[model samples]
Target: MPRFPEVAESSVGLSDAVFSRLVARARERGGKVYPLHVGDTYLDPYEGARAEAIRSVDHQRLHNYSPVQGEPALLDAILAHVDRRSGAALDRELVQVVSGATAGIAVVVDSLLSPGDELLLLSPFWPLVRGTTQRRGARAIEVPFWDRLESMGDAAAVEAYLESFVTPRTSAIYVNTPHNPTGHILAARHLDAIASVAERHGLWVISDEVYEELWFDEEPASAWMHPRLRSRSVVVHSVSKAYGLAGARVGFVHGPATAMQAIRGVQTFVTYCAPRPFQLAAAKVLTEGRGWIASTRAHYRELAHRAADALDVPRPPGGTFLFVDTRGRRRDGESAFAFLERCVDRGVLLTPGTASGKDFEDWVRLCFTTLPPDDLHEALARLRQVLDDR
Candidate 1:
């Protein structure tokens, strides 16, 4: 065994920064690299929100650490937003603020999942979810859904998966709506189907709704809002994508008052509390930044549509990305890494599907946010050339 307590084998490994290392090496050689890989917006912080942050930093109270749960003002604002949107009529005590959605998920996994417990992951998932669950020594079992979006769109398929796959050892079910790689938003029927599964199995539903506000055709149904599902579900949301405050790193989780208390206990040990000034900025954006999310969504939606038109693959239903499939030229399987490499040879960069799971080998997740019309067009054009060329 290796040193350091035998380092319990876990799945989480290597940050997406691995791509940056590759891109950096290419740059050093004067190779062109267009970075479409990460979901992060190249867009600068929302101007108004940034100004508020700078101003808040000047406030004497911000220099100190926040309360272990969160600052009262920020916490209350989050609760009000949740009550309004989730339509769950939750009290302030049910919410705990954290550094980001990722941190909130960590608290949930640490509190609820145990070693050997089967954790249900809905693939293609965001990479961090897989990393966090496995790091806890819990087995991550993926229930492939979106790849069969056509079939999964029929609620019966999702219902069957839930009915057949969940076992007594299943501790949690993770839902990523406005899903990461495929960009499929979970509809009310889908939520109803999942809620039924959770209700029957007595499982915890950990819903990551960081992109809830970015839904394309309709509003997303909150799992916590389902009457039968409310008691067993915890909802996580962030100011990053919607408010263009990714750097602020402020998010909240709300659910059962009992579970909220447990999350607070976990939060105390990890981050203590989110940064005071960042919380202050997020609070303002949530309560007063309506125009910001709308403008950003419209801008991103236009770009996403353009990407779909440009790429050879079908478009994702709704989200900030277009997951492109490029498998025509390869004899072995065409992986996201291989596709990304091809794009990099040109002047474009995109994330490989392998980061999510081996299942996404043919899928390339390309972020369409922040790039101006001309730049997005150019990037897509370059991507086409890379795939079409040798």
Candidate 2:
């Protein structure tokens, strides 16, 4: 039905450049624009885990392809890391390394979803996931849940709310915590609710644990560790957010052996293998980066408080961002894009809330960890002015 040059219908209208215009406008303003729109940290990774520390002299054939499952050392490190955290040992056959969580999630969706299948996304989610499902010709059903957690009543209410979105086409539910946009960690009751729904409907659970090491208070339990969800869940982990090694692009996935077999088969054609040298570096980081994580967590926690104070929002308990409701701050007749432009005029850029979910058009996501303390303070000051209509 399509012409030669036409792209697939599923790929059309996908978010390719949601922030390009704002970025270009920020550049035109030409004065110390702080990019708080990105989900990253200003800190460098641990010394032993840096790419420069992994040398060809130390690692034979460092540039060559790693085994699709992962480098043996990295695999062992991941297994040990899981054991230490979850108190359960993972069989090596259950793990497969991929380019990053982004690619890793894509591979899982590709393996689990068929055309027209539905994946329930907890709303105000990481922005790219909707597009990830769309590219697979699957529907991403956004349930407005995260931002409303405090007012959503009990765990029974949460379960009912999520269940309302499930249909015969529903095949999976993707859960992330210390969640993106909002920093809410799902509590035990919340996890129980999710597991109950998955069990009732026979849905696969996709646990996103990229921020597993970035919580502010006590570490939240991994969602995949729920006994009922364990068999059907595939958990994805990354050193990118935890170790400030986003450029390294290394992450791993593990689940039950049966699900892993499908994931491993799909991974072979997706990325073949993660970058070999970085896999070695990631292994070192996983095995030895606890102190680094502790310090960075303290640093980010401080920044979260500072940013929240400046913006007059509650401090995020975990993760790097604050999802702010800008409805009350916007001028009469002003659009969300116009509100963002005012911030850009002040030489600060934040992500539009619409990027996270369709229901969040008047909200915005600000990443407190993207800039160093001084720059972030300055950016928050400028952003505060816009929010205050100064």
Clashing pairs in 1: 34-349, 36-349, 37-351
Q: In the order shown, what is each candidate's alpha-carbon RMSD?
A: 2.6, 1.1
The TM-score measured for candidate 2 stands at 0.98
TM-score of each: 0.91, 0.98
Clashing residue pairs in candidate 2 are none
lDDT scores of the candidates, listed in order: 0.76, 0.91
In the range 1-390, model 1's lDDT, one tens digit per residue, is 446756546633625464674576457657545567667776766665684554644677666898877778787778777767766566777778889998889889988888889888888888788878878888788777777766665566678877787887898889888788778876667778888888778888998888877866556666556677777888889988877777788998888877788899989999898878888888877777777777777777777777887875665566777776666744356554665665776767676676676687777677887466777788889877776665
Model 1 accuracy (lDDT, Cα):
0.76
Which stretches of model 2 miss by more than 4 angstroms? none
Write model 2 residue lDDT over 318-376, tens digit each, in one string.
Answer: 98899999886888889999999999999999999999999999999999988989999
In model 1, the Cα lDDT at residue 43 comes to 72
Winning model by lDDT? 2
In model 1, the Cα lDDT at residue 172 comes to: 84
